[model samples]
Target chain A: MNDTSTAKTGLQSEAGAAMKQNRTAEGTVGEVYVDDPRMTCRNVDVYYGEKQAIFDVSLDVGKNQVISMIGPSGCGKSTFLRCLNRMNDTIDICRVTGQIKMDGQDIYDGGLDVVPLRASVGMVFQKPNPFPKSIYDNIAYGPRIHGLCDDKQHLDSIVEKSLQRAGLWEEVKDRLDQPGTGLSGGQQQRLCIARAIAVSPEVILMDEPCSALDPIATAKIEELIDELRENFTIAIVTHSMQQAARVSQRTAYFHLGKLIEVGETDQIFTSPRHKLTEDYITGRFG
Target chain B: MNNQQQHQKTMERVQQGLDRRYRKERHFRWLGLGAIILGLLFVSFLFITIISNGYTAFQQTYVKLDVFYDPEMIAPIGETDPEVLSRANYGGLIKASMRQMFPEVTNRREKKVLYGLISTGASYELRNAVMSNPALIGSKAEVWVVADDDVDMLIKGHIDLRLPESDRRIKDNQLGWIHLLQEQDRIEKRFNTTFFTAGDSREPELSGIKGAIAGSFFTLLICLTIAFPVGVAAAVYLEEFAPKNRWTDLIEVNINNLAAVPSIVFGLLGLAVFINFFGLPRSVPLVGGLVLALMTLPTIIIASRAALKSVPPSIREAALGIGASPMQTITHHVLPLALPGMLTGTIIGMAQALGETAPLLMIGMVAFIVDVPGSVMDPSAVLPVQIYLWADSPERAFVERTSAAIMVLLAFLISMNLLAVWLRKKFERRW
Candidate 1:
């Protein structure tokens, strides 16, 4: 521990030249767009009643890649993620003014229905909130509501395949009739993941899905995220910088409701361009 | 060292006050326990008083008589007609049997007193028996007939026999006759089936609460059918769909105030609207039920709203996050989670409706009803109203019947509360 602390301090002082005293400039540093994007967000501002929560944020989520958003508490990362699927509409006073396009079509258009949009872009909460039902029912809920299956047999296959993809089939196969809430914390999170996948969504938004689990469970989820990236574009907001470095190809750093930096994960962690991002990644302050 | 000495002084002060602190705590605990014990004492006292006062009403006194139903006396018109047989002087037959048993009562007034031993309802009983079996005309059968209400009170020790003959309803001559009948085993007490099967009557011994029970059943059926769905729907709309604004707040306040409104005012409203304006018949369960439903609506709505509110918001979010519509989410997730609470509330409201009497009284349900109600439109009495009417009577026997009716009402209330508890326990889920 002492050797690592000395090494970290040595590294911090060497990169201390990038740190600036006035860190209030609002423009984002590094790359904010990708060559091939699945979803594009530009000039997004969010407000709760009269209080502005996010100001003029722009970023791109590349196709079939995991982008990790790391920020302090109340930094608007989760709020921005909720805006992607229009989940913020459930709030009475929340208002969003921006253009978010999925495949070059505006998602916030009045003609667009949130039902199909949510079905395509599913979310997993920070807490592993499995429905108080059987494991089989939990997995089949999405497909049943969306009318994606032709018959009971097809629904059964979808439930089985979703669970297999989430890496929870072997553990829970014998107890498909047991309540989803009766599972361990890690298994419950995976069940939520399998539930999201049951609808065959194109993108999965995860809001600190492993914050409520132990180290072993976090490792298991990190592994599952790597496996899920082959078929789905994933955006995850995390409090842990190590988790962002481990599972993401792109990293976005938010500070006080502003997107401070967005760049390749290896470059952002190794050589941060913005002072706020350098200070945040170096454990100087949140 | 000086700092340590100051700390020791503070510790010493605390130690000195510890006993006083503990004494106060003990005093508070004992005060709470005393309050609970006082409440329990009152409840037990009430139950004991009711049970002791009412238990004797379950048994009725009967007089055994050997009546020779002669065909000559029964069909004196010689028509062999059912109407003539039913109109036969069954009272004279009982008189003859009593004369045979007590041959010394030859004076006219003594004969009148002797005839008073059997209830006037017994003549109707005998007439019905003879009507059902015309062949019984020539038979001599020993039948146990209901004694008069005064005789019942005397046999049950409610009538003070120590009082002077002039002060007693049962005179000296009546006592002598009852003693003689008791010695011969001719007088007996049996389970009062008449009290359960018969309807209201001028004679206390012939009256029962069967009509009131039937009326209560119909009234509560109508009340639940009207109140449950409408109350639940109103609660769901207010809690889930309506925006939280001044209008809904005012409505919420009005509903709460309505629950506290006097029930008699509702009775007056029922009289004006249902009986006068709508021209519904007086003294029927429909109007009574309508009145009770109006009274119980606020209670049901409040309970259902609380039940809906108890469902964690996370469940609603989970459903909505999965692309389920608002209606679908509430129906599939929120409603199922809240149903146990709603049903519990509805049962409690029904129990409250069952015990209500004042509103029913305003609608004229206090009138004497003879036949058990066959439909909601029939003139009827409810249990509480029956108890009220009986309690106002001058008869000693009616007092016991009043308490017995109260016991029945209490039993219905306790069982409904138990059912509510069981339902809540059975469906109480953990998040």
Candidate 2:
């Protein structure tokens, strides 16, 4: 928090002002949490080789609360969401330098193992990936690998309960042995959510989970998200401003790799404090 | 000049351009189709020629003869001893039996014709007869021995008896005896089990592919065992874990180059390293298999990497995001999905290895072996080397044997490729 404003912000420089203006906009950044946070990210900077993706982005995911990050494309919303669980480690050229803490422990410490860290902070991707296994196996994968259940009956119950929580159990009960890829796109996404929850994670980071779905499936997922927040802390990155307003209790608007403004979902949509956030929400220029 | 006229002119030009482009596209497609048809036709011609020339080798001709196993002639001591029977002049007995069959042929040249009807290996049958049944040592027994190459060709109708005697390998006098044997029902054609049961022999009828087949089997077995695990591990390391650096890049380039290297060069390497340096037995399936494994490893690795690449990145992300470690993710997910393609590639490499001759030849597998290889450590000659040996022989009957060996090799290759196709179909993920 102490390094928030002065350390970064290259838009106001005299040199390259005209060229940078297209991608950079003035914004205020802070981690606004109403209650104790399950996780905290401070002054996070992401770079892909020479190009910096996220600049001095600070955020907090409130315990058992749903926080949605909304921005236009290339605004680093998804990149910052991935930073919570270190999902960006998959990219060879991607480099992240920052402080990320989960449950009072440093997630990015050199000795910290990524396996348990990922297990604690599970993720649902922009696209549904069901591991080319059966629906039951897909949900059982996390628990089986983590040894959460000792026997087959216990693993089966966990899978059943997770699928029930995702609201896909009734639809897929008889076809648990069928390939998860055979499901509809929306069902596949729900299966992914079930897979993430089966691990019993403390937090779930979703990167545009419903972007590929139609209106009906999207509405169902938004409803499911509201229910999921009661059990697990959630952070989602989305392109739709209405979705952010609908699903999240707190909304953080990002512009040009910087958090433009953050407040409660109601206040941010009703009266955004930053001009860029207001402009982005009012559909003036995204 | 007017706006409407300008628009019409532009439309006309666009229409002409579209027509010209369509014609070009059509011409290119036809050219491609023609090339494919020509290639297929050439392959069909080769198959037809081989099938027609080689199908006869699957059956061999035999002649039934009555041999008087006079105990005095075989063993003067009147004993059923293996040494006495083995030392007996069975070649003289074969010639004398043929003379008894045609008592009217007394001229020296005509006696030569009668001698030509029975194989020189007829003595082998006589020796085997006395050795197996010592009771036959003093008795007259009727045994069906193999016919000579000239008589077999004449009976099979491969030789043109209608031609002048000077122009035919089967002389007119030989054909008269062949017809007499036909009338007496003494000559018969049976399924050539010997072709599958014996090894290379100087006599065409006695030669078979059993040795080469066993050698190929052992070599491929070793190749699969070593190449699969090592190739898969190398592929996983290169694909999933290896850092992108100049060192890795160099290793990748060399792997690809090794894949393209000639099989003979590998033979030379095997000779230098395995035979000279390690002092392993020459012409053994063990050294041949090691060489084949080296040759196939690159292909397996490349194929496995491709299969790993085909797996969507989202699957990797999902597994990692779920707390599975890197090795776990591969073993649990990536490797399972990539295995089908890996196996397919391995089979293709094995098929190529099975047909490999130059490397095995250089490693001394070109030696004429008369016994089927019983183990990998035994001196062996694979099918391709047998085919090479037959192809190089001066005997006219060896032509049929060469093509027949090729047919067997092709059968193995086809089955391997078919297995690969079936595996791909069975395990391929739609995702």
Candidate 3:
């Protein structure tokens, strides 16, 4: 692997110049700085009844970037991802504390409805779960509920585009009316991804999307994940260190409910940092 | 060299022991399979016996009779009083008709034995005919009606009078007269259409199950109209909306316990509450249906809850995540998935209610009803109670009828269970 600390500085400068151009387009002279993170978490703790599953962990997720959470088993990485979308609320015993915000708005505010919040922040589960419906219906469910489609033609177009973006359009276009479950495992996962994207969510959370797939399918999903970052903010939880290094710009390493380290993925993988991170990367201990 | 020989001998002994164990295991496997096959055969034998003994009861024997009504005895010297004619004793009418047919009978006891050959309802039929048409009071008319049980059995080969007069309900003289009538083509066995068309009666020879069949139909109608919506609503609330707490858990346990409670207890409760407290008429199909509904509620609730639980949580999460409200999630996603299971449970519960006799007996559904129930509130008798009443009768003919009724009940139950199984197979989706 190339040591690219100097190249990283160059990329940051280029991103800064792009942001300046984005501001000037609207005739705005940076009157209000974009300092507020797209999602901000502080001292968030999760518990399953009396057992605390995630300790005090704080993080920031920027808009339009890929953030990967990587850790060993039982490290609460999946738990944290669930917290982001309030998916933990489905579990009766799971309790979450501390503030999580999106666009400077507290997501867990009592008056806010979790339904639309989840619509804005969609989720793909660890295992591919396709509804026992036609592939078209599965993709249409989210959009139909959110009223994103104006007519049949519009809904059809949305389904086509979503599948195309998920890199599964060519294989499934002719059989959109078939049962979603009739597809192969990799195809089903892609269908789920296409389903999540159909709602046009601002952020998509994938909890080990490729864990149940073979090497070829995993490589395809990794390529799709790289393509997806251009349109939506993405948070992925994976156990594979190489996946974290390849797809994510920033990686957060969790160990036993604690955020052991969070930094540039390349820095975390190559440089000496926290002892736990080092021990985990070198395969001495996880 | 001595140590090497010892090692070889030990290896041979170990292999021999392994082979013996394997042979014993194989023998036990065959024994277990044989035991299972024997158990299945035993169950099959029981079912075959029930079907064989019950099949003969469906076919019944009948005799066509023409009775000549005497004008003097019925119209009574031009008085033309309907009350007098209605009160006129019909038993004497039947006996006089028998004596006129067989004028050779001189003994009073022998005449009485001959009178037993026709049903008591035969006199009622003659009376009804005369009363309906006063002009026919003086004319002679022939009526086709059911013969008495002994006469029926004799024609059906269930009776033999050659044994002895003291040992038989029908004597040799009566049998000889019946034989003469048979030779003259007066007594002929016809298809028993009355068994299906007529209603229940106190007289065993004239009784039919039309009343009870109507009663069962009305009762089930009321049950389905009441139990299905209420049971499904309660289940959805408890399963999807209620928080996990001690109160909900207690309710859950009570529902399971209620399912296990004896059905007769529901009958007693209905008796005390619906009949005595609420003043609903005794023996009404509505009351019986309400009692059955109470008995089947817990079953429906438990089954609906299980169906709801079987739906994967991801489906609900997906719906809610898409801005669908809790009610929307349930109505749009959950209920459709669980409908087949709910229907299966409802049908099975209804079948169980169809066969229930004890609870119905407690609530007065066992009463003899000669008219078919016209409304939900009308007095009626259900099929199981009809069977119970028939089985308790001292008449030998009722025994066969009871078995026939049982066969009909079994047919209904089998069809209902088959429908449930078919529905489950058709609509149960795997995710």
> What DockQ, on C-alphas, does every prediction get?
0.57, 0.80, 0.43
Best by DockQ: 2
TM-score versus the correct structure, for each prediction: 0.93, 0.92, 0.83
Q: lDDT tens digits, residues B332-402, model 1?
A: 99899999999999999999999999999899999989999999999999999999999999988999998
lDDT of every model, 2 decimals = 0.91, 0.88, 0.81
The sequence of per-residue lDDT tens digits that candidate 3 reaches over residues B346-422 is 99989988888778888999888899899999999999999988889987777767777777788889999999999
Docking class for model 3 is acceptable
Clashing pairs in 1: none
Off by over 4 Å in 3: A1-36, B1-49, B64-145, B160-163, B181-191
Q: Where does candidate 3 chain A have its weakest 10-residue lDDT segment?
A: A24-33
Regions more than 4 Å wrong, model 2: A1-33, B1-4, B67-96, B106-113, B126-142, B161-168
Q: What fraction of the true interface does each of the listed models get right, in terms of native contacts kept?
A: 0.50, 0.89, 0.52
Model 2: residue B250 alpha-carbon error in angstroms = 1.4
Q: Interface RMSD (Å), each candidate?
A: 1.0, 0.6, 1.7
lDDT tens readout by residue for model 1, A82-151: 9998889888889999899998989999999988888889889899888889999999999999999999
Q: Which of 1 and 3 is the better model by TM-score? A: 1
What DockQ would candidate 1 receive versus the native complex? 0.57
Q: TM-score of the candidate numbered 1? A: 0.93
**lDDT score, candidate 2, position B196:** 96
After best superposition, candidate 1 residue A192: deviation in angstroms?
A: 1.7
